[model samples]
Target: MPATAIDIGTYAVKVISADPGKQPNIIRTVETLNPHGIAMPIDDLQIEQVGELVNNIVFDNKIPHADIRLSLPESIVSSKVISIPPLTDAELASAINWQAEQHIPIPKEDLSLQYKVLYRPEKSKQEQMRVLLIGTRKSLVDRFINMFIAMGIEPTLLETHVLSLLRSLDIGADEPPTMVLNIGATNMDVVVIFKGEIQFVFTHSGAGALLTKTLQQTLGLDLQQAEQYKRTYGLDPNQFEGRVRNALIPVINTLTNEIQKAQRYFASQFPQNTLSRIVITGGTSQLPGLVEYLSESLGTEILFSAPFASATGEIPQENQQTYSVCLGLLMRELA
Candidate 1:
């Protein structure tokens, strides 16, 4: 049975259901924006509203009430790649718990931990396995699970957005090391993948919302008008005699600086791997000239995310980037 994949973002909720077999036709894609002035689901009222919206989508679309695969914002999850001495399955379980204590700041009792061995030497006698550790606050997990349960849906899998994005893109082992920048409304998620494995994941507060705020404060436009201007003249100095561009340049510079820092850090850790390309996603990534600007600033080939490359669907061109996370979650469920 096909599973429903939902990405509940700060500004919008995107849901996609697809038949994973036979070219993966997308059954439906539902996107609903939050009400004015409500940025994220920070309170019970907003959460309840989101649940209702999802329930309506399921009912209207006749979506099966089965196990749903969900993707959480990167802000709620902490992921790291660590090395450990190769051990048997039983020993690995114990070792991961011990290692989690040192790496995860939350108390073990308050966190839900998951791990996967990304690489293990086949013939080396003194090789260590690289393991990916994901830790989430148990309460947050439970809340989302319960929310789904309330709507008669089972939460089968919950993954961070970065992993889902990587899976959706289906970066191949033959491809060079690549970086993905997901600029959401409230935060930005940066991920580095090499040889089909995730090397780094980081989330920060500088993203679309910052740019919106800057425009609103500088131009005295309302939230809606500021957002319109952002999409219309983002980083394009030719617009409004460069007034909008000027308002946005500071934030863009800061974002690029952070990306450079991340690139440098990754290079320091893995000198053998050179980043070949950068893929930008999220709703904000659609801003005019963002691709060209980022390419010029980072001095790397920059591309927009196209998550539907392997899936045959009638998705709108404007919505492809916004639905990258949702499509990735569907891909994960199908896999």
Candidate 2:
């Protein structure tokens, strides 16, 4: 049996088994419900339901005592990829602390910092490691830590949604710099990778909800109808396509601009880097014609990321393509 990591996402609670070489079996996954019949936003859920959902998933799955890999919301954590001369683990830890102070707006004393070393190839004395340093308010970190402790589980690795999403992309050793985009309920996390390492990541609010709101406003449709239209007609301008393209232009423009900015900065730093492909994941990534629209707009080949690349013949092929992040959490141990 593999160790388990439970990801408490904004939209749902996902319990993933950390099997490394095997698929991260979905021990349990459930969307929290509001008793009042009004679907409360993730942030507005009562505190008890958060714990209840987690506990129920763990119990229902008969999962106990696995190394948990929980995700901190993008708003709670700060992420930056910094390059530094290769050093001993001790030196890296100290350097990351100083680097965190420079990049993170919060005072160092108020936050807990962690770093993941991305690329430090063996060979040269001048080789540097591209490190992803994450900083979160001490209080917030404590709350999550305590939440697991209260449930009798201790997380071995606590990461942000961006890290988990990037982990899901299955970047191969021979692959070139690629862009990974994850569109969630209310936020989108974009990470730029080169040579199987992350160079930059940015999180943006307004993902599916924005599209739904646009449809609701422009077409005078309810939320469910708008969502259905978005899934069916995304960015298409045909008669059945509705006005989604016009409504989503602003949001897509903003997303494209952010990607452009990251690409520009990445190019200036690594002039020789070649971008190979763009990977899109998450629920909204399933939007019809969205990939083609992005390809035309961004001028790059687009691919939908399937997170089960590392797993063997465990999960059925059909469901493997979806649940990339939940599966990636389980595969992190393998990586």
Candidate 3:
């Protein structure tokens, strides 16, 4: 079977279709500006706009529509991890709503809740199962469904960008604990993966837009020039005589501080392990000197994401980071 995935971001929307395998053949890829400003938890009024956008993208590129998976931004969803005594499949199906009520702030009636059994203690009677609970407004889900219908497309799955980001990486079991950072236009997610399994996610606000604004303010450059300088110089000390790096440091410190706290807490929880490397992705993360700066700040190895390395296809160099989530979604069926 082939897989087609769509990733909608604040500034753009990307679609990809590929054959199913470890290194599947990439059929086609399309990316377009989201000129209509459609949001994640879209309103009823915006459904038509989203539909129009999807209609144009799919039609513009001869994308094979199979297992159409869509990724929703994490900001519109509420998630929590809870522990409960292990239960049978039937028991879990019946108990999930109740568990959701205790962990999620949304009203049960208005929420569309989903859960995944993250861990189960096989031999220990005293240990409880850990479940990942994800919740979002029912209205939001309905709107996305309606939008797809209007475009004559039946979506096979609705998911978050975090899972897709994880899917894009090729984490090794023997590798040291690693952090995956996704810094997008409006938000950021720092996920810690230990021994090829996701341990937790640390989300933060103020990402690329914030950094660009900081450059604009301190450098007295227009928004366009500021963004250009941000990409060209980033936090690299040697570039631009270190001015751009200096201006951006204070702003980046806020995120580095939060990530460092998460690192400390994870260490406390798993005393034997350390977060050694960070896999940086997303358009903002591709900044000229970000990987080096983050590695220095956290005292960890940093690697930029190369999502298509294992996939048999050629993609634009700049689009590599931007398309990570969609590539991961495609992997759900392909790999």
CA-lDDT, candidates in order: 0.82, 0.69, 0.81
Model 1 misplacement above 4 A: 21-23, 36-43, 333-335
Q: Report the C-alpha lDDT of model 2 over 23-49, residue by residue, as the tens digit.
A: 454444333422332112233243455
Ranking by TM-score: 1, 3, 2
Q: What global local distance difference test value does model 3 have?
A: 0.81
User: If scored against the real structure, what TM-score would every candidate get?
Assistant: 0.93, 0.83, 0.91
lDDT of 3 by residue, 1-335 (tens): 77788888766788888874556568777778777645573666567677777887887786767578899888888877788998877999999998998888898779998888877778657798778888988888888877887777788887888887887786877888988889887788888877666777757888888998999999899977998898888888888899999999998898888888888988997998778778889878888777777888888888888888878865655668888888887777532
lDDT of 1 by residue, 1-335 (tens): 77778887777877888765324678777787755324334468866877787777778878755858888787888888888878777888878888998888778889899898888777656788788889988887787778778888888788888878887788888999899999988888988888888887888887888899899999999999999999899988888899998999889898899899989988998998789799999988888888898899889999988888878766655568888877777766444
State which candidate has the highest lDDT: 1
In order of lDDT, best first, we have 1, 3, 2
Badly placed stretches (over 4 Å) of model 2 are 17-45, 60-67, 120-129, 239-241, 312-322
lDDT of 3 at 329: 79
CA lDDT for candidate 1: 0.82
Instruction: Point to the candidate with the largest TM-score.
Output: 1
